[model samples]
Target: MSRGTRAPRAVRAAAVALALAAGTVVAAPPAGACACGGLVDGPAYDTSVSSETAVLQWDGTTQTVLLELDALSNAPEVGLILPTPAPAEVALADPEVFRELDALTAPRAVVSDHRWWPELGFGSGSDGAGGAAGVAVLGEVRLGPLDVTTLGASDAGSLGAWLTERGFQLPETIQTALAPYVQDGWSFVAARLAPEEAATFDGTLQPLRVTFPSSSLVYPMRMSAVADDTQSTRTYVLADHRVDRVDPTAEAYEPTVRFAGRVDPATVESAELAALLRAGGFVTSHEQVFTEPGTEIVSDFVFAPAAADVAYTPTYSVVADRRIGPFFAGPVLAFAGVLALAVLVIWSGRRRRAPAPTLAPRPAGA
Candidate 1:
C-alpha cells in the first residue's frame, strides 16, 4: 500500500471524526504488530503498536476478554477493531487486572547465588444502508474516551465497506484478511477514542473488557494479518484445566507456553477477575510471535485442555551477589591454607637437613 501524504494538522480533527475502528483484544506498540486485529489511520506518521496483552477467562458457557494496547502514533487518533463469535458487551477494564496477571504468571524467579536481571469491538448500524447490506449494528456504547460499536456482517466486503464509509482506511490486504471472520459469521466491535480525547492521547490507553458467550476458549487473530510488521502476542488464559493453543489446520506455528499452573483467586484484587477464577483452576500463559501474520496465521487461536495437566512456569536463575566474596571465599581460603602448609613443610625439611650436616661436621672435628 502507498504511504499516503502526511495528514495536515487541520485535518486531524476531521480524521478523528472518522471512525477509529478496532476489533478483538491484544496489544503492541505503534511500531510493533497489533494483537487480534485493527487498522490505524495516518500511516504517514510513525505509528505502530507495542506491549499488547490479552487476558481471557472462560467459564464453560461465557468468556470475558480484557485487552490493552500501547499505541504510538502522531495521528489525531488510531483505530482498533475486534471480532467475536457472538455479540459482545464492551466496557473499560481495570488496568490492574493485567498487572495482577503479570505478577501471577510472571516467570518464577529462582535465586541461584548469582543474580542476573532481565526484564475491542463492535457493532454497528448507524447508517440506514447498514441493515440492508447484511450488516447489523448490534449495539453502541461510550466508555471513558472510547466510542465502541458492535456489528455483525454477512460478508467481508460489507464489513470493509462499512468501516471505510466511516473513514477507516481499509486496504485491500486488510479487506482480504477480514474475509475469513466474516465468512465464519463473527461479530465485530469497532472502537476509537473521542476526537478531543485522542488529540492528546498519550500512548498509554485504558484497557477494555469484552464479555460474550462461546462454547470453547479462543482468541481472535485472523484480523491481525493486516499488520505490516511482526506482532508479539502474549495471552493469559484462566480456565478449569491447563489449556493450550490448537491449530485447527495443525500448522507448525503455535505459541509457546510461558506458564501453566493453578492460581488462587483470593490473591487477585479485582472482584471481577477473582470471580472469573473462583472455580479454582489453572492460568496458562502463551507467547506467540507472528512474523508474517498474513501467511503464518490463517486461523484464530482456539485453546483446549491439554492432554496432561502438567504445570509449567518459566524460571530464570539469579545470582544473589555477583561478587565472588562468598562463592569463592571458602575455596580461596582453603587453597591458601594448603599452599602455606606445603611451603612450611618444604622449609622445615631444608633447614633440618642443613642443621644435621653442621652437627655431623662438628662431631667429626671434635
Candidate 2:
C-alpha cells in the first residue's frame, strides 16, 4: 500500500495513521533502547539529542499505540526493543498523528498578566502493555521497512546472552537492567530496519504501531536503570481520564505535569484521537525523570479511571497558591498600598488647594 494510506478509519482519532508517508521505517543511534521502548543513548552524536513521542489509546482492555522514533541515515544497522504486557501485532505507525499531537499539546508561552488594577500579570508556562517470555521466539513478521520479531527471555542473564548471540550489538548493562521486567514476566517487540531498505533509511524511523491485550496501559520501564543518568521523557496520553502523577519511584526526578485539560478532538485531527478525547476525557502531557536501573513508575502508563464523584485537580495546581502567593502577593499588596496612598495624597492635595474653605461664603456674614 502507498504511504499516503491512512490507518484504519475507525482508529484514526484514537491513534495516528499507521505507516510512513514515504520511505520504510528506519532510524540511527545505538540506543541501547529504553525498557519503555525508548531509544538508548549511543555513540552516534552526529545528530543532536532526539525526542520521542508516543500516542496511546485504550478501548476497554486493549490499546493501540504509535511510537515515533528518530534515526540517522546511512547507518548500516538500527533496531529497537520494546517490552509489552502480552503478544503484540506490530506494524508501521503513522507520522501524521504525531504532527497533530505536537500541534495540539505543544507548550504555549501563556502570558497571564494578573496585575494590580489590571496592570500586569506573571507569565506561566506549560508543557503500553505486555507479557512474558522464554528463549521463546514467539514470531517474526515484516511491516514495510521493518523486520520484526516477538521475543521472550527466560531471565536477565539469558536474555543478554540471547541478544548478543543474535547479533544485536549492545552493552551488558542493558541486560542487567532488564532483570526486573524479565523477572516480572514481560514480552518484547524487537525490530530493525530491513536490510534492503537500510541504505534508504531516512532519519525519521516510521513509528512502529503495536496492539495488544493490556488489562491496563503499561510501558515496561524498569529496564531503563542502566541509563548513564536519569532520562528525560515527554509523553502524551489520550485517555478517558487524566493520568496519575509521577513520583520518585526510583532515584529519578519527579515527572512534571504539563497540563490536564479537555481534549479538542477537532484540533488533533485524528478520528480515533478525536472520538476518544470527545468522550469526556483528556490529553495530558508530562515531562518526567526516570532513574536508570529502576523506576518509581511500575509501568510508563496505566489508564486511571476517573474516580466516581471525586473532583480531580492537578496536584501542582493544588499547591499553586503557595507558588505564586509570595511572588505576586507582595507586588499586589504593595500596589494596593501604593494606590491607597495615592488616593490619600490626592485628597490632601485637593483639600490644601481649596482656598481655605472660603468661610461658607456670605451665609457666615454674622
Candidate 3:
C-alpha cells in the first residue's frame, strides 16, 4: 500500500486532464516508505504511503475494521487493493473515532518537583478485486468521494492480471505476495478515490470501515510485504480481554503493546464506535516497525486474548523544579551542609590553639 506503482499512460493523461480542469496544482510525490494492505496505483502523481493505522473491533461472530492511510500523492486518481477472509461491507468511518481513541489512550504525564536543596534530577522517557478469468465481481458501492468494489478470485494470477488490465500496474513481487491470500480463499476489496475526491486529497485519506464475519481477530498484512522499504503500523484492538499479537508463522518479531485497559463507554463520542466498544470493554494498542517485510511478515497479524486482562498505562515522570524557596535539596544540599560544618569545626580548633587571644588584650584593657 505504501509502494508507488505508475499507472498506464492513458490513465495518467486522463488524470492530468482532470487536475487541469479542476485547477489543482500537480506536484511530484514526496519521499517516504509506502505501506498498504494491498497494491497502490496512482494515475498522474507518484504515491507513497508513509504510515498506516487500523482499529479492529471483534465480537464473537463478526469483526469491524477501520483503517486510515497517511499517503502523499498528486494524482487525480488513486486506487487500493485489499484482501480479506470474507466478503465485506465497506463504508466511511468517522475520522473522529480515531481522534477520540488517541485522546483516551494517550500516555499519562506525571510531573514531580526536584527540590535541589540543589535539586533532584530525574529522567523519563517515552481491497477489491476482480478481473481476469476466475475473477468475479461481488459488489460495488460509492460512499462520499470513494468508489469501492468487492471481488472474489480463484487464484492470485487471475486477480493480478485483472487489476493490471484495469490500470493498477501490479509488479511481479506484488502478484507473488497475493498468492497466499488467494490460496486461502480470501476475497478482495478495491477502493479508489473519485476524481473529485482525489483532487482534494491532501496527505491524509479519509478512514474506511469494513465489516465482515471472522472467527479470529486479524489484521490483513501479508500483502504489505511489497512495500519498497520498512513499514510502520499502529493497531488498536477492542475485544473482551487484552490481546497479544501472534504471527502464525512464529516469526520472532511482534508489535509492542503501547496501552491496554478497559475503556469507559462515556469517553467515546461516536455512537457507532461506542457500540463496538460496549461489546468488548478492553482496548489494546500495538505498534511495530516492519524492517524487512519480505521476510519478517510472512503472514497476516493474528491476535488472541492474553491470559490476564491486566490494565497497562504508560507513564513518565518529569522534574518540575530544582530549588524550593532558597534551600537546596538532594546531593547539593548535603554537600553544602557538610562543608559548612567542616569550616566551623576548623575555626573552633584555631581559636582554642590561640591561647585565648593572648593576655595582651587583657593588659590593654587594664
* Candidate with maximal TM-score: 1
What's the alpha carbon RMSD for model 1?
9.5
RMSD of each: 9.5, 11.4, 9.7
Once all C-alphas are superposed, what RMSD does model 2 give against the true structure?
11.4
* TM-score to true structure, per model: 0.74, 0.62, 0.72
Write one digit per residue (lDDT tens) for candidate 3, span 113-177: 55454324796500333356888888888766556677788978878777766656565666777
The sequence of per-residue lDDT tens digits that candidate 2 reaches over residues 338-360 is 99999999999999888754555
Output the better candidate (1/3) by lDDT.
1
Candidate 2 — number of clashing residue pairs? 34
List the candidate 3 regions with Cα displacement exceeding 4 Å. Answer: 1-36, 42-45, 74-76, 112-131, 196-205, 249-251, 322-366
Alpha carbon lDDT at 139, candidate 2: 76
Error of 1 at 193 (Å): 1.4
Off by over 4 Å in 1: 1-33, 113-132, 322-366
Candidate 1 structure lDDT: 0.63
How close to the true structure is residue 285 of candidate 1, measured as C-alpha lDDT?
Answer: 82
Instruction: Report lDDT per candidate.
Output: 0.63, 0.50, 0.62
